[model samples]
Target chain A: MYKVKVYITLRESVLDPQGAAVQQSLHSLTYNEVSDVRVGKYVELTIKDTDRDLDQLVKEMCEKLLANTVIEAYRYDVEEVITQ
Target chain B: MYKVKVYITLRESVLDPQGAAVQQSLHSLTYNEVSDVRVGKYVELTIKDTDRDLDQLVKEMCEKLLANTVIEAYRYDVEEVITQ
Candidate 1:
């Protein structure tokens, strides 16, 4: 099986209100050194053993549903899992 | 400076409704090979240069807010940023 770890984040040009709120919360917590806080999504996908090209399949999945390319960008790491 | 990438996810024992929803969506899209979808949170923390022990600070942050030890688990990657 293949385990794909996907990370999706708002584009640098996009405003991140949730991030801002978290930043403010941090500031209130006295973690003043923290800045440029950006919040994102982390998705883990487990795919059954298949012959399809993993890269193409993951990219298609990201483009079609995992990520909103218009405002967010996504990247992934794939690892093979051995089932005993 | 340090850039910390944090990934927070529900514990294996915990149920993930968002993940199930995404799994169903993927199935509808005909990605039948996909399974075991888990959804999580991705946070990017930009920390200013400091003399404090980074490992300790990050651990505290995760325990205090980033991860709910009761039901969520978190891991992080820290990268040193060379500011020119």
Candidate 2:
């Protein structure tokens, strides 16, 4: 099986309200050293054995559904899992 | 400044309904090879210069707000951001 880790984040040009809220909360907590914050999504997938190119499949998935390419960007890391 | 990347995932024993839904969608897309899915959160924090221990502060933030430690686990990667 293949273990895929996908990270999705807002485009630099986008504003993230959730991140802003968290930053404000940090400041209130006296974590004044926090300069900025951006929230994102992480997705982990375990795939059964497949003959198709894993990278291509993952990219397709990300572009089609995992991420909204219009405002967000995504990248992935794949690992081989050995299960007995 | 420090760019901290935080990853929060549900505990292995926890049930992830969102992940399951995504997996079902993938299956409907003919990506039937997908075996499992887990959805998580990724947070990016830009921290200002501080003499205090960043690692400790990050841990505190994760435990208090970034994650629900009762059912989720979090890990982080810190990077030094160089600005001229």
Candidate 3:
């Protein structure tokens, strides 16, 4: 089996209103050192072993379902899981 | 400056319906090799240099505002950013 960690974030050119709100809230609560904030999604997937290429499968899933590629970019790390 | 990456995830005991929905969607799209899924939040913060301990400050923010400690757990990584 494999464990996949995927992170999807807004593209550099895109605006992230939610992140701005969080930053403002932090400032209100006196965390003024925070200068910028960006909010994104993190997904963990446990996959059974497969003959198909793992990276290709993950990319396909991210493109087709996990991420809105028009405004978001995604990257993933895959780890092998040892099962007894 | 420092770049802080925070990941907030539901505790293992809590059920994740959103993750289940995504997994179902993936199965419908024929990615049958996936066995489990969990969805979480990723927040990136750009922090100005401060005398306060960086890790403590981040942990405080996560406990006070960034994460719902009742149902979620958060972890962070801080990397120093050099400005030329």
Candidate 4:
């Protein structure tokens, strides 16, 4: 089997209210060393077939459904794995 | 400073089209042993201070801005790091 890891995040210029809130909380927690916080997403998947032309398909998926390209960005990595 | 890593993903019941597409790509690549694929997001943030109660703040951030709690879930980890 193969494993895919995906990462999604807002564009750098975008204001991240969620990150700001986390920063504030870190300040309150006595984790005074924390300065800023930005939040994003991570996902992992296992695929059954690996003989297809998955690169183009995955790219299309990112463009069409996985991400809202206008506001977010996504990247993925593929790895081979042993399945039971 | 403190480093915060955030992970966001769709719930189990949600259809992950991006993941499916990637799976197809893997199959084409000759990685035929692959199975199902799920896609998610990952974010890393560097905070200047870490003495505050960041837990509550991060939770609020996740609820209000970091993730769409209705359809997505988020989790985070914090690490202390030295900054120049």
**Candidate 2's error at B39, in angstroms?**
0.2
Q: Residues A3-84, candidate 3: write the lDDT tens digits.
A: 9999999998999999999999999989999999999999999999999999999999999999999999999999999999
What TM-score would every model get versus the actual structure?
Answer: 0.97, 0.98, 0.99, 0.58
Please state the i-RMS of candidate 2.
Answer: 0.6
Residue A2 Cα positional deviation in candidate 2, in Å, after optimal superposition:
0.7
Query: How high is the lDDT of residue B47 in model 3?
Result: 99
What C-alpha lDDT values do all the predictions have?
0.93, 0.95, 0.97, 0.69
Instruction: For candidate 1, write residues A50-69 as lDDT tens digits.
Output: 88899999999999999999
Please provide, for model 4 over B1-84, each residue's C-alpha lDDT reduced to its tens digit, 9 standing for 90 to 100.
Answer: 667777888888888898788668766764445567666766576766634576775676567655688888788897878767
- Descending-DockQ candidate ranking: 3, 2, 1, 4
- How does model 3 fare in lDDT? 0.97
- Candidate with maximal lDDT: 3
Clashing pairs in 3: none
TM-score of 3: 0.99
Q: Write the per-residue lDDT of candidate 2 for residues B1-84, one digit (tens) a residue.
A: 999999999999999999999999999998999999999999999998799999999999999888999999999999998989
**Clash totals for all candidate models:** 0, 0, 0, 54
DockQ of each: 0.89, 0.90, 0.96, 0.41
Per-residue C-alpha lDDT of model 1 across residues B1-84, encoded as one tens digit per residue: 899999999999999999999999999998989987999999999999877888888888888877799999999999999999
Where model 1 places Cα greater than 4 Å from the true spot, the runs are none
